[model samples]
Target: MTLLAGRRVLLVEDESLVAMLAEDMLLDLGCEVVVAMRLDKALAQARTGSFDLAVLDVNLGDTRSYPVADLLFERGTPFLFATGYGRQGLEEAYKAVPVLQKPYQAAPLKHLLTRLLMGEPPTREGTGGGPMPCGCHISREQQPFQVDHCS
Candidate 1:
């Protein structure tokens, strides 16, 4: 079985099609998936749900999913952003989080989640508390989020 087998994952995406596609990918990876299509619903889940990981959409139509990210952060839950804009879309406060560039493919998604679930340090690319490609710096005081492993 894959590392993702039997894991519980929270997937927050505003678009129905994208959600379905991601859910299918996760299911194929043998994960138990929980889906949230709105900010409020995602918040509620993030606040109380027991999940091994979460994939959050940076944009949720009229709102952003940063609040959900904050909640997950406080809980020490590992999550990554899924966006078409790549890392460029993230705000300064969240630049360190791993991002899954959109048009989500099954292969890269599996690779990232597997690496994360295995307790490997997230590949931060150029955002390792250094200046981004855009010449913006991420604060060292902002601790990187950790992924909790399932027993």
Candidate 2:
């Protein structure tokens, strides 16, 4: 439906190439994306953009993305993170948000984001919760969902 087709999003990443690919994938998923390559920029956009969701990198160029996450949380915006170092390496506070490991394709990203955006709780893969294939980026350090796609 067109309602899902034009969902607005805010994307935060420091890498230019990754930013471009992720923007494309979000567009394919029907999101009109706004990008911020730094934490400040992302926070600015997160505060100002007409965003329905966010796809944020866990670490920005020089700062952790927790502040940005806090802003998104305040607005009740759902998000999926794109992390290169995997959930195993993050602080306890950040383990709850869904993650798309680096080198992911579009399909899984869509599945995860859709579930979160639709107000579906992301139960950690082992708790017999939301979606099946057990990609647990929720409530704990997930085992890292890897799809092996370059983009």
Candidate 3:
């Protein structure tokens, strides 16, 4: 069985290509994906959306997505930060949250999501003695409307 089966995920990313890649990966993992490409839309969804977990981009254009993160935290929802600048890009308040650096591959992404949503540790073999990489940060692309889907 897939690791993330039946889990719902809220993916907040400003970059279109990155969002699409994430969506595809999440689908492959058997999780439902809800996408928001801007801070306002993401915040609205964060306030009202039902999700098992969230993947938050540290920055949404010129604005930070911390408000959304705060909302998710208040809702008791688990989340992680996706940043191009790595953990250094996050504010001190969120330092303990997991961070997925840019240019990551599928294995680490799946591993992290599985760990977060399922409370399972990533396999130790070949994990490089640290947090696994997950495809998060990528170059920007044209904006797309919000979407929610599962495979």
Candidate 4:
């Protein structure tokens, strides 16, 4: 059974190729994905879009997506940050949020999403920690998924 079946996901990414790949992965997980390439569009959708969860790129071009994140936070939405800089890239206020390093694999992404959506603690194999804030920050960067743009 797919973990995210019937779940709607808002994917905020600036790079088209990365978005395409992530969308494919999300579809494979049985998730309905809404792609937003720019921060403004993502913000609009974040405020009004009906989605179960969101995956936001930390940086979008010259601007950051913190505003969108703030809106999502206000709405009590669950989200994960996809960034090339890992947890270090995020500001102190956002350190506790789940982070997925760039170039991620399908399996880890799936595991993380499952945990996030199911409200479970992130416990994968040897990794040990108390329940993560929402998701775990996996640092390894995969080769195929590179961050071309911030948003």
lDDT of each: 0.77, 0.70, 0.71, 0.75
| Candidate no. 1 TM-score | 0.79
TM-score of each: 0.79, 0.76, 0.76, 0.79
TM-score-wise, the better of 1 and 2 is 1
The deviation in Å at residue 28 for candidate 4 is: 0.6
For candidate 1, the 10 contiguous residues with the lowest summed lDDT are: 130-139
lDDT tens digits, residue span 115-151, model 4: 6776632232233443354233434353344322112
lDDT of 1: 0.77
lDDT winner: 1
* RMSD from true fold, candidate 4: 7.2
Q: What is the lDDT of residue 31 in candidate 2?
A: 83
- Which stretches in model 3 have alpha-carbon errors above 4 Å? 120-151
The C-alpha stretches of model 1 lying farther than 4 A from their native spots are 120-151
Which is the better candidate, 1 or 3, if ranked by lDDT? 1
Q: Count the clashes in each prediction.
A: 0, 0, 0, 4
